[model samples]
Target chain A: MNPPVYFFTDFSSRGPYLGQMESAVLAVAPQARIINLMNDAPFANPRASACLLAALNDYLPENAVVVAVVDPGVGGSRKAICLNIGDRWYLGPDNGLLSLLVSNAGAENCSLAGLHESYMKAASASFHGRDVFAPVAGLLVNGQSPDTFPLPVDGMAGASWPGELAEVIYLDGFGNAMTGLRMRNLRDLQGVVVGGQLVKPAYTFSSVPAGALFCYENSLGLLEIAANGSNAGRILGLEIGSPVNPHISPGRSKNP
Target chain B: MNPPVYFFTDFSSRGPYLGQMESAVLAVAPQARIINLMNDAPFANPRASACLLAALNDYLPENAVVVAVVDPGVGGSRKAICLNIGDRWYLGPDNGLLSLLVSNAGAENCSLAGLHESYMKAASASFHGRDVFAPVAGLLVNGQSPDTFPLPVDGMAGASWPGELAEVIYLDGFGNAMTGLRMRNLRDLQGVVVGGQLVKPAYTFSSVPAGALFCYENSLGLLEIAANGSNAGRILGLEIGSPVNPHISPGRSKNP
Candidate 1:
């Protein structure tokens, strides 16, 4: 479509593919805008990375080529992938670091970048963020033929990540902290346990007594845990980099 | 709620109102968890403050109070407000600051606190973010009466505030500085005409050929002006803490 484009990399603990990706983008599509989405999720947690990926549609520029990398199962037996969903393309490990985007992007076709002799670079250990993912994305951004670099396959052993992590990604002006918990989860609080304490009767901050702990849907539509006139993060020991855990309620349907 | 809450306020920006507002919460509710929401929105332009508001929703605790203080017309003539949107309540000025949320919060039955004698903690000449808005929001969290503190007005004034401001706000890691452009006010093929030099379109570091000029959308979804391979903030002779005048497309609409 000849629109502006960028690369959104996850520079989490896995680090970044800045040099190679930058080189690839500069080598060809030098006119396309390139950006680093983020490389700061947890270590080797594809699910967490996926959660971040889900927020992309709402916050990222539409039509931008998002090349993300949060692969924990780097190297080894894992498979690298390029997934085209709707009008967008995502190049990363097929380990569901992109699973977070399933509900939104809806993968149309996924091809595995088989580690053949010509496909991969002479890389180092645990540095795929720089060596592999970055170059692949930049090459794609430059409109290079995908088949020119690597062959397509199916199924790479994805990483196993299971946790109810709702972190405070940012805070608002009015003192409202927006968590990773979306509106769907907040409105359906069944069995919520924060800091060894059970959150009962989840509702508005004002729904209960003044001092009572309350859980409700924040303006951004996420489930937030708060109290009237008190600091929930400090009092509950939930810091800026902490994750929220949502326990499964017994005898309840998963869907709300 | 009993969750940890943190606000991104600066020291002295909210001043006693921050603690006092927290105190107001404890005065009645006695057990509200109040965290520090930042008291800095680059002089508290409600529109500038609007960006902080949205970001906080992404990274805030499940339930917390964010206290922002970007009020320029603090004690002038603007009215304090509280919005009961979805599950969270936002407290701030009526002027277009919360304009972004009016449609989402069901502006029809939205709530506002009338000017109160008791809740007015001897407000300063121009520090509503510290004196008024903070304390009232604190009381709301502290389990105090929302209607008791102030009278409810239909809504605040200045719904359309485009072409009113004259500066830049936040910047990105790429040094692609985001201007205070109201999103809708940008036009196509609009050249950057600052000080008579026509800005060149350098999509990436290479396209600029000399890394002199670049333009693109920053990570925060705002149109940005940047310099390749160099800090545009420095090269362009602009400072993040300062302001700038941007050239917009004539047909661009203004954000409310």
Candidate 2:
């Protein structure tokens, strides 16, 4: 059996876009397993989303094909590309959405290639996620390589972008604010300050007083601001692109 | 190959509940195709949810197994049951969640049964969707029958509930309010009044002026109130359980 195909897109969960893309995958690989890894990514902000996407790398198994689409330039001149990073494959627009993942994997560990021209010819102007990326993923999981031309890492968009973002990149259902800064890189920090509030670190919600604001490393290992037993995002007035500053003690230096 | 497993639950899209339940289905039937039919069902209001579920019946294919989990009575004395309605199978708590679907299929066409005792014994108090319903669905799709006892139609909760509900039951990603009233059943009505605003019927969004509120039959065949390119739900302040009263001319009477 083929490996599962995972979708990570800015398409909100309630729309028909996700379902249409799933149908496009099934059209090519009828027996393939599909998972909606994350449908509610930071909308149309690829630079910020790249950091969150990299944090979710541990969830993708070897041989899995991930269709990452946060393209605001969908109908523009942005090139469609595929990247072979580690044992998994990523099919998406050449915009900065996949750049952070590629940079994290290092140049030697990544192979970048432009998707075949035929896909673009057949794709609709606005919805390349359903038209281009999803079908490419289906074919990849079916063990058939879509035609492609090799591209240099330097030519990729957002190749020089920062590895981490200090903004709230996502808000989960419970209204917890997930920042793009990885916890591993911020080990020296005691907490984060958001919306003029000092949010201290806690192991979990239960470890803190109910309704108290706290920050912790979420399952994806990102620093997330949450309120125990309450809507932290609403209480703190946090939204996508909200700034989050590291709170380090006077004696402790930030991660260098 | 087994039929696909569809999940209809109140679990919001951003949480771990949906993903964990998907994992459980894969564990039992490794090759089964899982689709998230609907994750954001009206939270804990299965009576309202039943009307929405019955409207979505057209999406299910023959032999498909749907795990309906709008369960608020979890860990309670409510019975776990399975219903073979039409050619599709449904596994959920007997807390009126699946009652409308069963009634829609007619009593003679439905076969209601209690799930095997072993499933209940092993299921966690909080999440039977993962432990009980998901595994039972996987077993059915794989052609293995879990133990069950026959049940009469009258034994089902909400079995005698109204065929249609005239309240806002769901809101889609675009904030369009979806009422439980089916459009087919209200052909004689020119429009409906929601939140004290008169909403006229139109074929689609483009037919009306931009930002104008109008009602139409959504793809699911239910009455939905939408603005041309804006959020009608937000503008009108409509939410789940908001009453919708049909507006008919003096010559026209309500559906009989």
Give the candidate number with the greatest TM-score.
2
**In model 1, what is the error at residue A134, expressed in angstroms?**
3.1
Candidate 2 CAPRI classification by DockQ? incorrect
Top candidate (lDDT): 2
**Native-interface RMSD of candidate 1:** 16.8
lDDT of 2 by residue, A158-200 (tens): 9999888899988877778889888877766777889889989
The C-alpha stretches of model 1 lying farther than 4 A from their native spots are: A1-24, A58-62, A71-77, A102-119, A122-127, A148-154, A159-182, A185-191, A198-231, A239-252, B1-256
lDDT of 1 by residue, B1-256 (tens): 6433344433232212343344333333344565555544444355655644554454555455544444444444556666555445666655656555453344565554544644455654334554566556556565555554544333455444433233456544565566654333444535554323556444445567556776654444345677767777666666444554455556654342
| CA lDDT of every candidate | 0.51, 0.85
Candidate 2 lDDT tens digits, B19-120: 657856775677778888998899778998898889887778887899999856666678899998766899998989889887778788999999978888
In model 2 chain A, the worst 10-residue window by lDDT is: A55-64
Question: What are the clashing pairs of model 2?
Answer: none
Model 1 C-alpha lDDT versus the unseen true structure: 0.51
- Candidate 1 chain A least-lDDT 10 residues: A154-163
> What TM-score, over all chains together, does every model reach?
0.43, 0.61
Q: What's the TM-score of chain B for every model shown?
A: 0.61, 0.97
